[model samples]
Target: MTEKTYPKVGGRSAKITLVLLVIVYIFNFVDRQILSVLAEDIKADLN
Candidate 1:
C-alpha cells in the first residue's frame, strides 16, 4: 500500500493568494462606497 501526503495550507502560494483576495475585496469595497455616495447625484442626472 502507498500513502500520499499534501502540503500545509499556509504556504507561500496560499499567502500570495490571500493577499490578492484582500486587494480585490478592498477595490470592491471602494467601488460600492463610491456608488453609494453618488447614488442621488446619478439618479438626479439621469432624470
Candidate 2:
C-alpha cells in the first residue's frame, strides 16, 4: 500500500459532471415544455 501526502485533481472531473448535468436538465425542461404545449392538440384528437 502506498500512502500519499497530498492528493491531486487536475482532471476537474466534478466540474465536467456538473456541466453535463446542467445540459441534460435544460434538455429535459425544453422537452417537457414542448409536450405540455401540445397537450391540447392531443386531447382534441383523442375525442
Candidate 3:
C-alpha cells in the first residue's frame, strides 16, 4: 500500500496569509463595533 503525503502549513506564504487574515478579521470586528455604537445616532439623524 502507498501512503499520500500532504504539504505542511509552515511556509512563508502561509505565514503571510495567516497574518493578513487575522488583520482583516480584526478590522472587520472593529468596524462592526463602531457601526453598532453609531447605529442609533445614524438612524436619528437620517430620520
Score every model by TM-score.
0.74, 0.63, 0.78
Give stretches of model 1 more than 4 Å off: 1-7
Error of 2 at 30 (Å): 0.6
Report the error of model 3 at residue 21, Å.
Answer: 0.2
Q: In candidate 1, list every pair of residues with a backbone clash.
A: none
- Model 1 residue 47 lDDT score: 100
lDDT of each: 0.96, 0.92, 0.97
Off by over 4 Å in 2: 1-11
How well is each residue in 1-47 modelled by candidate 2, as lDDT tens digits? 89868777646788899899999999999999999999999999999
| Poorly placed runs, candidate 3 (over 4 Å) | 1-8
lDDT of 1 by residue, 1-47 (tens): 89999877688898999999999999999999999999999999999
Candidate 3 accuracy as lDDT:
0.97
> What is the overall TM-score of model 2 with all chains considered together?
0.63
Candidate number with greatest lDDT: 3
TM-score of the candidate numbered 1?
0.74
For model 2, where is the 10-residue window of minimal lDDT? 3-12
Question: Judged by lDDT against the true structure, how good is candidate 2?
Answer: 0.92
lDDT of 3 by residue, 1-47 (tens): 89999988589998999999999999999999999999999999999
Ranking by lDDT: 3, 1, 2
